[model samples]
Target: MKLHYEVDGEEFAAAGQASGNIKKMLKQLGIASDVIRKISIAVYEAEINMVIHADGGTVDVDIQTDKIYIALKDTGPGIPNIDLAMREGYSTASDEVRDLGFGAGMGLPNIQKNSDFLKITSAVGVGTTVEIEVNL
Candidate 1:
């Protein structure tokens, strides 16, 4: 199965909509709870990152019998320093965003921890694309 979503960066309230939908689909498909949990967390964190930093993005999911693949792409200012961005507490979120109690800088790390495989490609002046896979 394949799923696609458009994340809206302008609306914080809509951030998790895609993730939530995916969770529901997983449940209805009778997917294992633990697998569903991991996918949910990964997607949610990626969604939040897109909203908080990427300005907006696209989420694509491919589910198969033995593995699941996810791709998130954004046209926002790409990470200038991926190594630093991977740090658990490093974040570039604005004060206004932080005031909302979001942007703890744990998103990417958490996504990596949950997925079986992960890759991130970014261009400082262009955009970013994150791909993650989980084995069944």
Candidate 2:
């Protein structure tokens, strides 16, 4: 199966809607609870990152019999340093974003931890694309 989501840049309150929908779909598909949890957390973090930093984005999810793949693409200001961004406590979020109780900087690290295969491509002025896969 394949799913697509559009991350909204204008609404923080709607940040996790796509992730929530993915969670429900996983449940209805009888995916393992642990797998569903990991997907949920990773998607939530990615969605929030799009809303908070990327301005907006697109997410494509592909579910296979032996793995699940998630690909996210954003046209926002891309990461200047992919290495730094992957660090658990590094963040570029402003005080406004932090005020929302986000920007703890755990997004990429958590996604890596939960995914069996992960790849990130970014350019300072261009954009970013993150692809992650979880083995079944």
Candidate 3:
């Protein structure tokens, strides 16, 4: 199975649309609850990041018999310090966003925690791409 989604930038109301759809699809397919949980969490965090930091992006999901692969690509300003970005409780979100209680700086960390494998590539002036793998 394959799924593709485009996240809208700075759209808090629609942040979880992709993740919610993926969750519904997984449920309808009778996927393992634990696996579904992990995917939802990872996808949600990635999706939110796309809207909050990346100014929107695309997510591609490939579901295989033994594992699942997800890729998120963004065209926003690339991550300046991956290490800092990965750190828990570290954020560059504006006060306006913080007021809405969205940015706790745990997006990437949460994705890493939920996926079996995680990879991220970014350029200062280019963009960012995140890939994730989950075992069945």
Error of 1 at 58 (Å): 0.8
Worst 10 residues of 3 by lDDT: 6-15
**What residue runs in model 2 are displaced by over 4 Å at the alpha carbon?**
none
Task: Flag the better candidate by TM-score, 1 or 3.
Answer: 1
Candidate 2 residue-wise lDDT at 36: 88
- Each model's lDDT comes to 0.89, 0.87, 0.88
**lDDT, candidate 3, 8-31, per-residue tens:** 886779889988987898788788
**Each model's TM-score, in the order given?**
0.95, 0.95, 0.94
Count clashing residue pairs in model 1.
0
> Which of 2 and 3 is the better model by lDDT?
3
Model 2 lDDT, residue 87, Cα:
97
Ordered by lDDT, highest first, the candidates read 1, 3, 2
**Which 10 consecutive residues of model 2 have the lowest summed lDDT?**
127-136
User: Which stretches in model 1 have alpha-carbon errors above 4 Å?
Assistant: none
